[model samples]
Target: MKPRICYTVWFSQRNRSTLLCEGLTATGIAGKPAELLELPPATSLLDFYQVNDYAALQAKLWQQRMTENGVFGMKANAPRKESDPIIGQLAKLSGLKVAAPTPYAVWENAFPNGKHIFLTRRNKIRQAVSWWKAIVTGQWHLEKGGERKVDSQVISQHYNFEAIKHLLLEISLRESKIQAFLEEGNIVPLTVVYEDFVKQYQQSIRSVIDFLGITDTQYPIKEPHYERLADELSDQWVERFRIQLQKDWKNVIW
Candidate 1:
């Protein structure tokens, strides 16, 4: 029997997980076509299966994903809560592979046998600024061929550095949590930085394909068509907030 690739990506919020997944799905793996399965937040296996009893349903869903080619890809963003019945079920579930979303520690426990891909952003300041902006605007992703609206009032005139500072703290803690899990598990993941992936999609995607043992001789490798959500305010806000954190917090590292 030929071996099938089962993998999951552990990412932080605002790190371009969607873009990466789309690219990965484009490349054909073996004789099997790939599909990116996404799990919603706060929903569990029971909710996902849509049944009060799910032992059989879980297996059915898993078998469905496996398809004819036997190659499967699935991703989930870490749920908001630390521990949930659904999350625990996902971690322990057999047969289905897990995929992307930020907050990887929980999923790490859930899918121990699955391949781990760690996608991250190098610029903490920029990531923090982007995350802060999204929280206020409630706009996380931009649609294809859609225009991005920047709120100058909230971004420029009345920007909240204190709130941003706290948000940065949260981001750092999450990153550290993922790092600790990696170390404890002794798992060396296929690490892709957001900036590098943006600059070199082919190389980045190729690295991932290689990791998964996917061979594509005819697939046309292209960069994702999505537009960035952040703008000038994102850069300026990050710079100003960094300086403020240095002065007020004494460059606190928590």
Candidate 2:
């Protein structure tokens, strides 16, 4: 049997994760189709399988596993605190190696033997501004299918302007930590910038393919359409946020 490649996308909300998964699926190397593996809301690890109906989830996993043409990748938001064992077990059962590019420390630790891909967005100011708008307008809550509530205080606590700056800083710090961990010569991970990933999707995918030791024909990269509404505050908003991002950038190694 060919080696099964298991991938997990580690990203905060609205980080172009869906597009990345599409790019991975387009490669058609591993026989696995990319799918989202979301955990059920308000479920603890003890009752995760019971609440999630593992039978259906396992069926999807089997379908992806049975693919004969290309690699299989899955996208998910940050795993719940309790679902770690489930992820680990699924990885073992499927013989899949994990891949994540987010800054979540838990997934990083969970897949210690797996490859880590750190993806950083180029325009932090824009990202923060977008996040801010999403929260105020309840766009963030809507994406989770309205099952999860978006607490303004929690948002303020976790993602306020200052908090966003720290989040960027945390991303930078994790990059360093991953590098240092690799320096011990355990796991060598790949890093990609979001700007480069968008502009050169094929190349980015190629890097991922090569890292996984897969040889496949190139796939045409499709550009995603993104439109910004005509708003007066974009420039000023970005300018205000840019100061913090610039400071964070100085600390970022790559």
Tens-digit per-residue lDDT, 196-223, candidate 1: 9888888887888778765555665656
Candidate with maximal TM-score: 1
Cα error, candidate 2, residue 2 (Å): 8.6
Give the TM-score of each candidate. Answer: 0.75, 0.56
Model 1 regions more than 4 Å off = 1-3, 30-43, 52-54, 60-68, 77-84, 91-113, 151-154, 248-254
- Show how many residue pairs clash in every candidate, following the order shown: 5, 7
lDDT (Cα) of model 2: 0.50
Q: On a 0 to 1 TM-score scale, where does candidate 1 land against the true structure?
A: 0.75
lDDT (CA) per prediction: 0.64, 0.50
RMSD to the true structure for each prediction, in A, is: 5.6, 8.3
Point out the worst 10-residue segment of candidate 1 by lDDT: 30-39
